[model samples]
Target: MDQKKEIKKTNDQIINSFSTELQTKVKTSISIIEEAVARYGYEGLSLSYNGGKDCLIILDLIHSIATGILPTNLTNPEKLKEIVLFYLRDEDDFEEIDEFVNTSLRSYDFRNYTKFATNSLKQGLIYILKEYPKLQGIFLGTRTADLKGRKQPIFAPTNGDWPESIRISPIMEWNYSDIWDYLLTKKVSYCELYDQGYTSLGLKSQTKQNPLLKQKNGEFLPAWVLSQKSSERDGRILSLSNSSTSTQIH
Candidate 1:
């Protein structure tokens, strides 16, 4: 199948797999996004994607909503064409994540709308906003369980000289299990690092296979195999400490 057809098929499958309750939540989220698009115009909005599972879910939601499959009253189909996507490529990023991002861009036909930069996320956003002065909002995949994500509202206005844009977190209420369920049920492809036990991803120097999922034969299980939410970030933290120690020794 062609890329567009494959993308539509995947989105249709995701919409079909939504449970009744999830369907309601998804509709509400779509409405929120549609309203934002209407108020700000697509040219004034952007998506902050990090090639993570949560961001992938948000992308799916946006696609479904924009294609009129989520039961929203949004009428501007062309609006989707104007909203740009930004990805911050860390210097030490995992190669698997980079591959996944490239695949997703082709599958979703976002090659023209996506921008990638190796600088800090803040700097990248600043550059984009400067290029498009009308940009007033950015959609994010931040969940409440994340450290800086706790207590974030669905729509948050920024302060200071950083861009005068609103931060939108549509999936802030979702948990780790909710994300996994949606991704698995939708048959969406994710970064290969997850299958190698990297639950919470970061730079390669700050991420490692989850020790809890390590087998006696020395093979590591997938991140989804972890039974506890508290252990999700264990591998990242451990890797950070290891890197710190190595730096001190050198």
Candidate 2:
């Protein structure tokens, strides 16, 4: 099928597939992206994508609205050259994760994707700011329940000591169930780690299959079925089950 026709079909499907609650969240998130574009222009915006489930949903949301939201210069945001994309590359990253990122950049036609060599999220942000001086905002795939997510506003600003840039948490209001519902209902592509019971992905050494999901047959369940929402990170070696803050940022 032609690119134009395919986009139209997918957009219609996306609108009809999600539940009413999820549709509302999707609309608000897209509106946030639109607001960011209005404030900084498309070229001045960026996205922090790491081939994870949360970020994958963010990417698909952008793709869903690309034909209408983005300028005509790129034909479609699927060309993905107008707005820069940043990935914090790490030495300890899972090979599967890296492969997914590489495949997605190609499949999405992300012509402006850049990778930072460091593992620290703080350091990666610093690197991107130094590399792209004109950037005014970067879309983050944050949700209401993530670490410090409940405390921050939708358009959270960087810390006083860090480089200044608008952190656009478009899906800040979405919850854990909403995340899974959007991904599965929309038929969106996601990383394979989730199906293997790694509910919260961290470094390869630190992350494991969630024991909460372990079955009597010595198999584990999918990430979405883990009953206790707070135990999502229990698979991690440094899981802070007792603390309110997240021990590791996926």
Structural similarity to truth (TM-score) of each candidate: 0.82, 0.85
Candidate 1: where is the Cα deviation over 4 Å?
1-16, 114-116, 148-150, 238-250
What TM-score would you give candidate 1 relative to the actual structure?
0.82
| Per-model tally of clashing residue pairs | 0, 0
lDDT by residue (24-141, candidate 2, tens digit) is: 8887887787778777887788888878777777787776566443222233444335688888877888888889888887877766889987766567678888888899888887
Clashing residue pairs found in predicted model 2: none
| Candidate 1, poorest ten consecutive residues by summed lDDT | 241-250
Best prediction by lDDT: 2
Candidate 1 lDDT over 160-250, as tens digits, reads 6655688887877776777777778767788888888778887777677878999999999987778887677777643333321121000
**Which candidate number maximizes TM-score?**
2
Q: What is the lDDT of every predicted structure here?
A: 0.70, 0.74
Predicted candidate 1: what Cα RMSD to the true structure?
6.2
lDDT of 2 at 239: 50
Give candidates' CA RMSD values in order. Answer: 6.2, 4.0
